[model samples]
Every structure is written in structure tokens, then in C-alpha cells.
Target: TATGWAQGGIAAAIGADDAPSLHAADTEAAGAGLTDPAVALRVAAEGPRLIDWLVSLGAPFDRDADGALALGLEAAHGRRRIVRAGGDSTGGRVLETLVRAVFATPSIEVVTASVHDLLQDENGAAAGVVCERDGARFRIRARAVVLATGGVGALYASTTNPRGATGRGLALAARAGAVMRDLEFVQFHPTAIAVGADPMPLATEALRGEGARLVDETGAAVMAGIAGGDLAPRDVVARGIFQALARGRTVYLDTRGALGASMPTRFPTVAGLCATAGIDPARQAIPVRPAAHYHMGGIRVDGTCASSVPGLYANGEVASTGLHGANRLASNSLLEALAFSGFIADAFDAMPPAAVLPEIRTARASSDLPAIRAIMERHVGVVRDAAGLQIAVDGLSRLAETGCDAALTALMMAQAALGRCESRGGHWRSDHPHAAPARHTEATLRSPGAAPSEPARTDEALAR
Candidate 1:
């Protein structure tokens, strides 16, 4: 995971949809089809088999009353494919199992350090990573480098991701001259716990699946005019919550009547979080707000998880395989990690070894992370406009004088969001409120400030 932890996610995996859950209209709205639907379905179909594999490795799961794996909360796409464990603590539980297995394995050697950059060979292929550990900087030389450095949620002031998710992988890849696609599409979770916490606690959408509703300070339905009410798509709900907060009306997830009795058992994690915040979900509503939760855009990769840069591979949230498009479907992240991890392993085994190169050391760039994060939250957040994006661009450019990779990654996202004038899926623009012709935005490190090279047809980028 990006946080250098055993776990790689928020850990809810989606199963196959029994029917055609995705549609053309919704896809158009989501800027979907960057990844083929058939590919997503194929990976999703392997969910049961993957679950069985994990079970054999000692991971536990929670089943429904019918003895079937309990499907998690339905998403905006109208499907209930999420399968979880330890109730709301599924990610932690899953990570624990993986950690134990890894430690038990004799071949694996764990390194505790922060990676500074990707080392490249004479032919411009990834060779290894430069890292800092125990107050000393060192380089580890290898034939290939795989970056799984997580997402950029920490770039925002209010986010559910750990602080280390500063888009380091994206920065490393970009610095290595790798192509990145769709850096603009960041997904904001609709109901993060609103306590004044740094890494805010998430109020899982499953609460709504269990019957909770969103309400305003006056106890009026927040999603009253929306079609799906509280069960609406994440972007919709997030926008609504953002507008509600803008209106000075505090929003909340009213679980008092919905999951009151079952709170402690079904959602022990959430219950404990609420208790810590001095609110009992069994009797009172849980205060909530929208938060930076996931990034849909990342380092561009092909079907086999190979990046544009030879010998470079990315997996987990760091790689953009075009699977999620402008917005990610819930619980698909873990599924992608499992599938691509296997694919990359197979690919790695088949490759002929590259000659070992000598280790090279370089100075690391220092950044004012707090200032950069503030600029992002203010300009390139849930809703954006040209002027704000320009301000972000200029601010990031100034920060980039330090050669900070984090600032560079933030600049790329702001540039992409600014160049994309139309509002589509997660890249909502207050200035450009309507969708234009659908296109995939691509960029490289060479020209960060240039407009997107002429838009390409949808067929040009979709996953096989």
C-alpha cells in the first residue's frame, strides 16, 4: 500500500454483477469506457475464486443470512457487488492476513524506508528505486521497479487517505518520463466523518445501504430532490453535501432509526469512531462531509500493467489502467490489485533479465506540503473553475522551483483539470457545467503546462 503498510486499500471488493449493471448513458456521464467493460467483468467474475484463495490462506469473511457472501452497499451504478470481512474493518482484516502470509514466506525480504525516486538505465528503463531509511539514503539496484505508492488524497486538507499518500509514485513515474493519463479525475467520498481530525474517519456508504438517510441541520432530507436519495452516486451526493455545507447547513448521516439496534454488531468500527467523537450512532446522527477519498487517474498502464516506460510496472491505485475512467466503481480497487498483481508477477517471470547497473545517489527536493495541500483544496477540489485552477497552476509553478516531485504531481493534476473545460464525472467544473465530446487526456513530464494534445477517440485508449 502507499502508506508502506501491508494493506493496499479501503478493502471492500466487488463481485460480478448478476446482470448488466453498467450502461452506455451512465458510462458517458462517468467518462467511462477507458477500460473495456468486458475486462472489468472478467476480473470481477474471478472474485469468488480470489476469495476462496484468500480463505485457503486464512482470511475470514462475513456471510449473509442466506449463507451467501453478504454483498456490500450498492453504488451509483446500481449494483451490490461488494463483499467484505470484519464488517467495516475489512481492509485491516485483509491486510493482517496478507502480512502474516508474507512474514511466513522465506523468500520475501521486507524493507522499511521511504522511496525518493526511480532509477533508470541507459536505455531509459526502470532499474531500481532510491530510498531513505534510518536517516541514511541508499539505492537498491534491480532489473525492474514496480511502483505501488497509492493515491494522492493526502494532497487535500480533508481526506480519508493516510498522510503518506502524497502521489509519490506518480511523481516518480513522471520524473522517469512515463506517460500519465486522467490525473484530473479524483473521487470524493460523500460522507466522511466530520470531526476535526487530520486523516478524517470515513462513514462508509454501506450505512446508507443499511437504510440511513442524509439530513441537514434542520433535519430536512438533504437528498430530497435527488432521484436515488441518499443512495445516489458518490459524485452527486458529494456535490450535494458540498452545496449544503456551503449554505451553512451542517450535513449528517442519520443512522439513528436505520441501523440503531445493529450498530454495535454490524459496524463495530464505525460505532467506535462515532463514540470517540462523542456521538452515539444508536441514538444520534453522525456528522458528515465530503472528503478526498480516491484518485481515478494515475500512471498510464496497459492491459498487462506495463507502463509506457519499459521495465516499469504499476499496480493498485497508482496505475491508471483506464478501468475506472473518470469515476471509480465502489469496491473495485481491491479486485484490481489482486488481478494485476498476478498479471505483473507472471510478466516478470517471463522477461529476460536486464544487466545490473551501478547505484546512483542524488539530492532530494524539499516541499512546503502544507501550503501545496491548501492550494489544492482551495482550487482543484470537488468543484473547480478556470480562475481557481489558474491560481493553483501559478502557485504550484512557484512551488515547483524547489524541484519537489509532490508539487510536480499536484501541478499535473491541476493542469489536466484546467485543460478539461467540460464537467464530466468526477472532474466537475463550475465554469464548464456541461459535457463536451468525450476524450481521454494524456500528458508527459516534458510539457506539464501545455494543453492536452488533441483529444483522441474513445477506441484509442480503452482496455482490451
Candidate 2:
């Protein structure tokens, strides 16, 4: 199973007073109009059903004494409908349970291997993934390939993703001539634990839902000036933290009075991590700052999770299914992944299998891992502009000129980051501060045979 360092609960319209329409509207607003209205409507409508399915599969979401699902409000939502597994430890708890269920299922096989490249047939249809594990290489051929390998958060210097989230799937898909979308829009979590750990552990946003306040070192409220304050949109909050850091002030999320004695009962993971770090949230404020958390852009896919290439499907963080748009609402990433996984699974199972054919020859290529990671961290990081993006594009292009498969992935991210023009969501361009006229720009890198005329800046075309 794939792993993520996600800390937020899955958002849904499960609250008694919440409706899918309201949730969809909130999502669209948070997505800044780049959201696909139809996708938003569909996901929101299916929210409750998906939640019910997850619960039935033994997700064990937290519930009140009356057996009603407990909900929490995250940064971007109109209602408190985020279903938690155990307070702020929702992602861990849910994934652990799902992993157990998946392991128990007889038909499913879990392989612990890292996929290096795609295995394609003579007709250019995807057949399987070439992977390596413990010094052994193997090809796991299947009728359909699902890219649930998560996001590129690790491309940044500081991120909240597992170390494996190096945009491998994004690069792999790109090299296979599959179209990628919106690779530029990255969502930085506003409040990662700032005690100076690499890939800094997170301080869940649900703390804010429990009434934690964002304060400066002087014990004064820092979010009073913003519209939503502590509950503002993620981008706004991240920028706020950035500004605070720029001024050399320590920013903190005061959870002392907010959570207090009930902290362990609500967020055991957070409590344990804090304790390990010599902190007591019930008694002191926790230092925090922004860190790369999610990628709003990824491999472009249709409504059914079909990529540009035949027989290749992508879901979860790897696929840009147009549900999250420019900025993903808090907790929606997990929901999107689950929803698309279901869609891809059902769709793949229903398709008739192609006749067995001879396997295509596979190739191994060199990778400049350090160079690609450095380039992504520098240019496509928290704050971006034209110059840095161009530098990133140039650097990746130089790497790709070496004819390595891994370099091609870096090239894809660089190209897409360069193409997106406006400062929408987490892709804040210093040159363009305001949101441009409403547009849904999907980040796409051009194939050799594709059009080369400035990448066609049209609604139908990909962003790059």
C-alpha cells in the first residue's frame, strides 16, 4: 500500500445541517474557479455514500455518544463535515484500517516494490509497471495500471509528505506520453510543526476547529486581520505564516486552552509526537510555519480516471481529476483519492481484457535524483515567479537532454510550473499577485509530435 503523511480527516457533507450543494459551492470558492463544476457536484453528492462505504469497510470514524459521526471544520469549508478517524489522527487511523481490510481480502495482492517505469505494448497501450524491490527487478503485468503513488510534495525543501512522494508517478506517466495537468498548483499547509525537523511533522488543522488560535511570539492574535482568521483559506494562512517568518517573528498555534485535557482523546498521534518533541500542547503553544503539503496539479485524467494513454489509469494524488481545482480544500485530498480509486477499480474491472500478446522490450535508464529534487525545491517551491520557473525549466531540460527516464519527470514538472501564469492558490507568482480572469489551466508538457506553438493557451489544451 502507498503511504502518505497526511494528517487531516476526509471532508464530506455528513453533518446534519450540511448539504452537497453548499459543500460544492465552498469547494468551488476555495478552488478559485479553476474547479470543474460537474466534478465538484458529483464528488459532493457522493460524499455521504462514500463515507458510509468507508465506515462499512471498518474505517472507524469518530462518533458521538448518540452514534452520529463527529465532524470538524478545517481551513476551507462552509460546514463542519470533516469525518475524523480519531481526532487529528484521521489519515493514519483510516489508512491503517483500510490497509488491514485490503490485506485480508483474498483476491488482492500487496507488493512492496518501487515502480521505475511503465511497460508498454507495440500499440502504445500500457501493460504493466517495471519495478524493483530489494535488489530484484520484476514486471507486474496487468490489464490496467493504477497510479495511486501520491504527490510531489517532497520536491520542496520542506514538506509534510512521506519521503517517497517524489513525484515518481507524475514523471513516470509523463515519460509514457501521458498528459499531465496542473502540476504547478501546490498546496502548502499553513501550520506544520516548526521545531526544525526535515519534512517537518504536521500540526493538524483540526486543532483550529477545536478553537486553537494562531498567535505571534508575543502571545497576541495574529489572524485577527484576516477575513476567516485561523479558519482562513490555506493559501491565505500560509502566506500569513510566510510573512511572519519573513519578519523574523515566531508564529505559533496556541492549542493550550483549546484542547487542554481532552487532547489525547481527540488526537493521540499529535499528542504523542508533541510529547516526543518535549512539548505539552495543553500547557504551551506550539511553534508552526508553512510547509509543502499537497499538490493540486497532477496527471490529467478524464471523469472516469482514464489518462491520455489507453489502458493507463491514475487516481489519488497522482491524477488531476479536476475535483480539487487550483487549491484543494482541507481534507478533500483523501476523499478524492478514495472516490477515484473506486471509480478506476470499477471501470477497470468492467473493461474486456485484450488478447494476450508478446511482451514489449523494456529498458533501464539512469537517474539524477539529487539534481531533480534540488531543481524542484528551488523554483517550484512555496513562492514562485517567472524567473525561478524559467530556471527550473532550463535545469530540467538540461537534465532531460541526457536521455534519462527520471529526468523526463522533472522536465514535466518544470514545464508545467513554467506554463501556469497567474498567482492562484498555492502557485503564488510574485509577478502576478491577483487572481486572473477565471480560467482552469491544466499543466501539460508537450510530446514531440504534439503542437509546439506556445502550447495553445485554450480551455481545451493542457496548461503547458
Candidate 3:
């Protein structure tokens, strides 16, 4: 789990009835970021089925007063597809339901361990995983390995992700030679409660969907002049907040007049979080700042959630299925995870019998995570320039001397971000602050004794 918890409220799962339009939103944001349009579209098209499957698994969903599906951001544009449970604790409720289902299944054995690396067979195919539990290392061999270790948010100082979300799956896959796509595109949530917490608490975008406005300390609307205002795409909203912060203005989510009396009922989770932080949404504006939230890029996978390496699979936030493109639509991640998990299961069932397991031995490398986090926060954050990116690349390269997987992952992202000269989606380059011809970045780990290389940017025309 990314947050060391079964559920994290990072994104909503359901979407509106117009799945094709949602697909277009994804394409517009991703803009040549996806590896395959067909695969991405299939995942989008499966949204309804995935929601139905979750409901069948005992997941409880909430309906609006109109008896319509309550919607989350982006999807909330003109349709209702966002559903919740226990007010704002939708992810928690869904996770609890799934955990119970897993517990009921006798064949499944849940192990508590932190995966450090992947094990490969003599033919270079994935065979198992290397994990550490309670300071003891062990190897778990399997016919098929799924990397769902989650995102790389912990690599940044100001992040809304759990401390455990340090890109372990990405590092393991890259080291094992899986091709990584879009590592440069990391999405920052626009409204993380600015209460000085290590893992910042989120102020869910659903609040804005329900009419809460973003404003500065002067009681001026921060998103006033923007076309969509508070209802803009996440990347746009996040940038708006980032710019406000840059200008020494304190940004806030003002729900007072909009959500006023209904704050606690409509957003119990956020209200609780606000209360803990000594703010009342009903009486005051909740202070907020942008925080590193989600990664739009990861270990690249195909339609079946299969990585480049046979016998290895990835799902959830760990796999860059391209459904999100450069910027992910709100709540689509959960849908993708559920939809692809089914696809992976079917693919696994059709696979040939596994060959004899191979004996493999590997040691986990330790990382100076705090140092890496500081470097990333300083150099590769929401906005980037050539000098800062170069500094980050150099700093991470030096840290790579420790043989740290986390450092390697950071280095990969910095390298890719540095190479892409144009500003697009979450990857904002102050130097090149305009969209260029759309392109996708692809990277592979270097072979021993070979010179390290930057990721290749595939032109949209050539990729298509």
C-alpha cells in the first residue's frame, strides 16, 4: 500500500456516462503521453463495469439528493459519476470492503513485507520478489509477479502521499529492465491543507466540485480570471495555487458561503481534517498549498497490465497505462486499477505453465531518503528550469554512488524532466513555458559498463 494503509483518498474512482468524452479529456491532458490509444480507451470504456464489480464486492456508494451519481472533479464538469461512501472516506470504505473479501478467500495469503527488488530467471524474465520484513530479508518465488507498490510522492518533502510511497515498485522494475514512460509527469494536488504536516492531508477536489472556491488571504478569488475558475483541470488549479504561493500569497479553500452549513455532511473527512488543523470550513477559509500528489508516469505497461518483461505485471498507480496521459482525470485511477486487475487475471489464466523456478539471490540497497527528498523538493518540484534540473541531475547522480534504488528513480525523473524542454501538464518548465509538439518520454536502465543515457522522446507522429 502506498500509505502503509489499506486505503488512501488520493483519487475518486467513478466517472460520468460520457466515457468517450472522458477519454477525450484524458487524451487532451496526456497529449502524446500514452503508449497506446486503444489500450487506454479500453480502460476508460470499462469504467461502468469496474464500478459495478466493486459494488458487487460489497462496496457501498452514495447518491446525491437528485438520486444521481455524485461526481468528482473533471468528471463533474457536466455529469454525475463520482460516488462516495461514509461521506468523504470513499477510498477507506472501498479498501475495507476489498480487504474483507480477500480475507474471506481462503486461497489468498496476505504477507506484510516491503518489497526491495525483483528476482529474475536465467532468461531475464521476472520470477519473484525480494522483500524485507522486520529487518529480515526473504525471497518469494511465484509464477507471476504483480507490482502494485504505488507512487513516488514520498520523494518530495511537501507531499500528500504516505511516507511509504517512495517509488519502490518503479525502482525495482527499472533495475530489472522494465521500460519506464512519462517519469517526468508528476501531478500536484492543488489544495493540500497547509498545516505543516510531514505527509500533508488533502482537501479533496470534490469540495470545489460542490461549489467551494479557492481564494487568497485577501479574500480575493485566486482562480477568478481563469476560464474554468475553481473547476479547472487539476494541473491548471495546482499551478494557480503554486503561482499564488510564489507571490507570497497564502492560498485557501473558502467553503464558507458555498458549502456553509453542509460542510460536515458533504465532506466529513475533510471537515474532520480541518477541525484537527484548527480551522472550521463553516466559519473560515481552509489554508491550502499544492503538494506532490500523483505520478502520471511509471513502469510502462500494455493493455493487459503486462510490463515489457514477461511474467511481470503492474497495476494501480504503479503502472503507466496511459489512461491518464500527462494529467489524470479525477477519480479515473480507481477505475483503471479495478478494470486492469480483471484483465491481468484473465491474461494470467491464459498463460502457459510456468517453467521450473530459478534460484536467485540479491541484497537490498539502503537510501538516504531525506537527502533525496530535499534535493527533489528544491530542484524538481512543481516548476522547473534548466539550471535547477541540471543541479538535481548532478545531485542525484552523486547520491546514486550509494547504490540506492530510490536515488536511481529520482535521477531518472530529473533526467527526463531536464530533457523535455517544453512545459506541459504537471511538467512546467519556466524556461520553455509553452506547449511544444506532443511527445512521449521512454527510458530504460543502463547495462553495466555502458554510459548512462537520457530518456528518448518519441515524436507523436512517429509514436502513432
Q: State each model's CA lDDT, in order.
A: 0.76, 0.76, 0.76
Candidate 2 minimal-lDDT segment of 10 residues: 451-460
The TM-score of candidate 1 is: 0.90
lDDT of 1 by residue, 1-464 (tens): 53222111232334455432342233323444455565565565556577777878887777888887776665554555566776776777777788899999999999999887677777778888888898888887777788888999999999988988888899778767788889999989888899999888888777888788899879999999887778777888899899999989999899986486687788877888888898988788889998898898999998778998888999989998766788876666777787788878888876555555545544447878999999999999999999999899888877765567677778889988989989877889999999888778888766322222211211122111
Clash pairs for candidate 3 = 12-331, 30-326, 70-82, 71-82
Candidate maximizing lDDT: 2
What C-alpha lDDT does candidate 3 achieve relative to the native structure? 0.76
Native-to-model Cα distance after best TM-score fit, residue 380 in candidate 3, in Å:
0.7
Off by over 4 Å in 2: 1-4, 354-374, 402-407, 442-464
Clashing pairs in 2: 182-297, 182-443, 442-463, 444-464
lDDT per residue (tens digit) for residues 147-186 in model 3: 9888999999999898888888887787677888889999
- Local accuracy of candidate 2 as per-residue lDDT tens digits, 1-464: 12435567888897879999988998888898789988988888888998998888888788989988988888778789889877777777788878889899999988887787677776667788777899888888877788888887666667777766777787667666787777778888988888877768888888887788999999888787888999998988898888888888999989886485578888877787788788999898988988888887888899889998888898888888988888888888788877777777778766555434444334434657678778877777778788998887777766665445445655666666666677887778888777778665554444522221222221122333
Off by over 4 Å in 1: 2-35, 65-67, 356-361, 447-464
